[model samples]
Target chain A: MDTIDNLADNQPKLVGHDHVAQINPLLPLRKWLYSWLFDPGIPGNHQKAVDRWISILIVANLFALLFEHVDVIYEANKHWFHWFDIFSVAIFTVEYLVRLYLAPEDREFGGKKFPRLRYISSPFAVIDFLAVAPFFLQAVIAVDLRFLRSLRLLRILKLFRVLIPACRQFVKVNAGRTFRQKVHALVFAGEYGGTLHNIFDMFIALWVVVSVVAVVLESVQTVHYVLNLQFVILDAVAVAVFTVEYCMRIYSCVEEPGFQRAVLGRFKQARTPSVVIDFLAILPFFLEVFLHHLFDLRFLRVFRLARLLKLTRYTSATSTLTRVIVREWPVISAAAFVMLLLVVLTASLGYLFEHEAQPDKFENIPQSIYWAVVTLASVGYGDISPITPAGRAMTIILALLGIGIFAIPAALFSAAFSDELTKEREKLKRDLYEMLADGVISPDEAAIINREARRLHLRQNEVDHMIEKARNDRESVADLSGLPIHRIAAKPEHAIEHYKALLGQIRQLGILTDGLQFEQLARQADRLTSSELALWRQIHGNHQSQP
Target chain B: MTDTPEQSGVPLALAPALTLADMSFLVFLAAILMAVVWLGRIAYLEGVKTEVTKASGEAWVQWFTEASPKRFTPGFEPSSCAGGASPAGTNGKSAGSDAGASVNPVPERLWEGCLESLMKDVEPIAGLRNPFSGKPLMFAAKCDTDDRSLVGAMVLEKLTPTPPGSAVAYTTSSLVGADIIERKLQLRVTVCDKGAYPIRIAEVEF
Candidate 1:
């Protein structure tokens, strides 16, 4: 503790060495270092570049560590590995030392006698210490190889530190943005024009594709062995991005429509289908870390493929399919149950008929189910077949029934999908018409239409087309416009405009002198003197109603 | 490789027995790692160009462990196998006397200390032994118990510089009978090779 306090007291007093004050050279240097390392307000790109360099160095060190384990690679590049380790460790050491020196510069960390000590004891500070300690220890002390390896694995934990804040600023939108509101805007489709939110979502979709592809390609044994490090890097990057996304969604889920209350909103979102997919996507990564030894983690990694499920939120087609299935669940489920019944019935029948002929093949009911699945799914692996006449007849009957039985669900889904597509398009059209009610487009009005279109997973071009159609429809209606006196007095504000236009047209007919002439006679007709009645009679040659 | 029949399976890797000093050192290393990562995060969040570098260095470390040939398999769980392990002492008479000292129906906490990661029931190698046994000396004693699954002592770890020719056998289950009181059971020594890992190559079972 005393050593830590002394270390804390020794924060870099020297920041800007050249501009150092005569009384205290350390203060300027400390300020300079703090800005260079911690302050994002720096206009210069140099500090930012330095951060990139560190990240690159970290990745490079990871590659180095990964290959360092392979026997052939280790044997060939022992010296390079050794020197690289030194160089990496030296850089990390310098970084750790500098960070420790400037620890007191952090706001919460300052104002204490041992602010540096407090910083050292903080979570990140401890990581920084451990990051460099291994190298120093390796030189002086002998460590158990396994223990050393675990220490090496500790490098991966650096991810939590790097990514936690990259997405943190996104959460902090201006003054009024609640975490829940941001989540609603980001996770759900309807937005009042948030380009950044949409772009972030697109990037997430892209990553999902890339990660799923990476996971699939990793199945090739040659690829797995030769590019194992690359795969690892990919998985790690995916996990980090996904972890950030999952946390962001949870944090701001309260802004979701149904999830209005603070804690309950998040809980409700947690149980939701799309949100469940998001959770499953990252759960494997964490579970493997916590329970690696208890279960076969190698098999567990295949679960990462579930990241594909996340794309459902971004595409109307998939979400539509989901909705169609949900709407037609009763039919589909009954079809499924019938198919299951067929499988059992067929298996039992095969057992009875083929048992006498091929006892070895039809050994048990469970074994025969494989044949049933093969026949019913129409896969027909030909690995199993019926030898007896009765069995062959049963097979033909089951196969004929299988086609219709399976098609029930497929046909049901197809019909439902078609209906859903029509509904969604109609919904979009309705939203567009609502926005164009006044026959003029405002930016806010346009945004609402766009948000609605986005919620329906409509493309930008599609949205533009739909809005254009709405505008054309509005213009086609005589009620929407007034050519002379064509507009209907649909609204109070439009009513005045409509009357003025009608008077203008009447005056243009060369009958009345002006619009005021028309207005004046109409207002004074009840108590009109003899001259007013004479003017009104002169303008109305064809008028039938005297009043 | 010479003493035993050649095994077809992947060879077991060594997990070095961590002493108190080594554990302290690891804790220090963990601390530094956390601190640097925090500083890096603060730098990145504060608008450092760290975002440009997408990889968080996690994959490399994870792959390093996962892809390694010397991976840990299902070795042993002491809590599940043995109630507590101590070297078998003098005899069943002394063990009975110790049990008589305690008067209770429920089990008692005879002694409790953190068991080391990998230790054997007895040191199989000439110079080495279970570090808990104050190395260079080894013993076997009986325990007072009625629990059938209670193992008096077990070979929890492998010896360092494992004998290449011997097959490494880690403890699967080592238990002491619950009903066995003091004079009921005695130390049964089993000199083994290729069983326990990186600590001692052999075990002496009681």
Candidate 2:
């Protein structure tokens, strides 16, 4: 046991020496090279490399496709292209081998001699295989039309995974900054303040816009011939890709051991507002692909453009806006429901009042409701108008309600924004108090606080003053009180009403406490007895009298 | 309502003025090319930089070890002795040589440099002889290998272009029958182990 302990004690030193010896020769040069190839915090280098390789492969595949058509190039360079395909296959094969070699041993299936198959079955590995598979398939399969290389375009999707990690990190860092802006917008729209929910609404809006445009564009008879089978194919492909992505995300989360503990936990972590946006954006595509065959729903294909909402995932501001919409959705929905009910009631009244006078325009309640919708939406098409005096009066009243309904989203958004800010402030207060209890603050911690404050747009001086006051208060009561009075005041109920306001302040100061001792505060609280409480009350009464 | 020759039949020759459909197809093709070019440029810049840096770093490591020997004693600093034959070597090569031997004496780097030099020497002839990019040329030849009598036999030639600046060139030749055309100025032929009596040519004209 002593020998083992002694060996363990010397192990790290020996390893360090070994590393120094091995790395010393290459250190200066390797450092320079590493610095050139990889930026310290930039997480996309590997992905970038993979993306480049994929691009090369795609281009090669495309050239192969083009070569088939241009006989001059094809006849002259047939042998060359064939050789190029072989080289690509060889490179891919080697890559597959290396990946199998590098992959975790446990993941190697059935302890088989041929581990490449196992590797290819993995998600990323499958993508890698797909990158090169189309060409190989074309080489072997005797198909009438050699259009399989078009499938090679799917390799572009792999780039998404490569960019995802970096993009996600970027979003995480900037999400807080944009959260307030989005919340304000949502409140102004009379929607919820959750960034994710707001994003969902934006996605819906995008879908509506895209569908309308598609329908409008399709309506033009001159261009209808141009829109052929390819449009349907594109829609189908888009739906499949999104559905696959959604399924994988959900499956990955559910398969995680921790996620199995709670169903909502999986949804909370996996069903991000962006993910919801992704689902909804692609939903129209799926609807068209599946339903178009069953019925004459070809016109609905225009809705597939709704997928543009997926762009929200790429921008922090948009994502935060989406969250705000989600947070305030229930309230906004309630308000909308009320507005809808009013529109229906008023439409019926208008139909009764105006149908006799303007038979062509207000033929039925449905037609009247359509006009009411356009008016309420602030989009008076001018095609339909009420001529009767009573009808005109009702129209004026309905227009006023439409304007009110338009303002509801904005009102809801403001309320939700305030709530978000409050939660953020409370969270900051808790974090600050906890840090103070740790009895130490590092520069990095300070920098973090400062950044946070700047992000929150708080007054730096005020935050500094607050942090100083807390620190001083903590120091003064360090010995006798065992816990600071300010720490007690920093509790959620006692802290500032606006969580964001406090967080902003804390961030500006960059105040961080390392190894905070919140357990000590709990212990101190445990020490408080009923007698002490009574004594505190008596002291408070005495103080009040003096004041 | 009748299917006219103009509507149903293939054009014997491409027209000078492109139709809208043809133009659209060309535009799509150009877009694909542009995307590929953009991606390729980024990848090439990054990949080449990374590879060059790695190579230079290894070279530096080799230079350092040659300059300072006593400072990096075996077992004292195993990592510094990497690329050497000793157990301390971690330069990715198997360690089983004398410690005093020259470090990083492997032939892989030499072979790669030779290949690159060969490629650069013959690059100009590439466009004239083989118009297609390097990848497809390699792919097609391998696919049609079985059609030839000699299944595994192939020839690779390193063709040096006239007045080469810094481009790689190669001509690959394969023989199947008397009618088959074998030699071209563009492709570099490295090996000819496939078939007997392959036809030879100087260059290909479009």
Return the lDDT, model 2, position A400.
Answer: 85
On TM-score, the leading prediction is: 1
Question: In order, what is each prediction's RMSD in angstroms?
Answer: 22.8, 32.8
lDDT of each: 0.56, 0.47
- Per-residue lDDT tens digits for candidate 2, residues A228-324, read 2223333343444455445434533433445553458558745676667666755654454345324444455555554665654434446445667
User: Please, what are the lDDT tens digits per residue for candidate 1 over residues B173-199?
Assistant: 322232222111222222111111111
Estimate the TM-score of every prediction: 0.45, 0.33
Chain B alone, TM-score of each model? 0.17, 0.27
Candidate 1 per-residue C-alpha lDDT over A315-365 given as tens digits, one digit per residue, 9 for 90 to 100? 667667778888888888898999999999999999999988999999989
- Per-residue lDDT of A92 in model 1: 74
Q: Flag regions of model 1 displaced more than 4 Å.
A: A1-195, A452-547, B1-206
Residues B1-206, model 2: lDDT tens digits = 22222234533332235446345544654664454445434434433332332232233234333434432344432232222233322233322257734564531111222223323442331212111111211212332322433222223333335454645443344321211111122332221112121212122210
Error of 1 at B132 (Å): 21
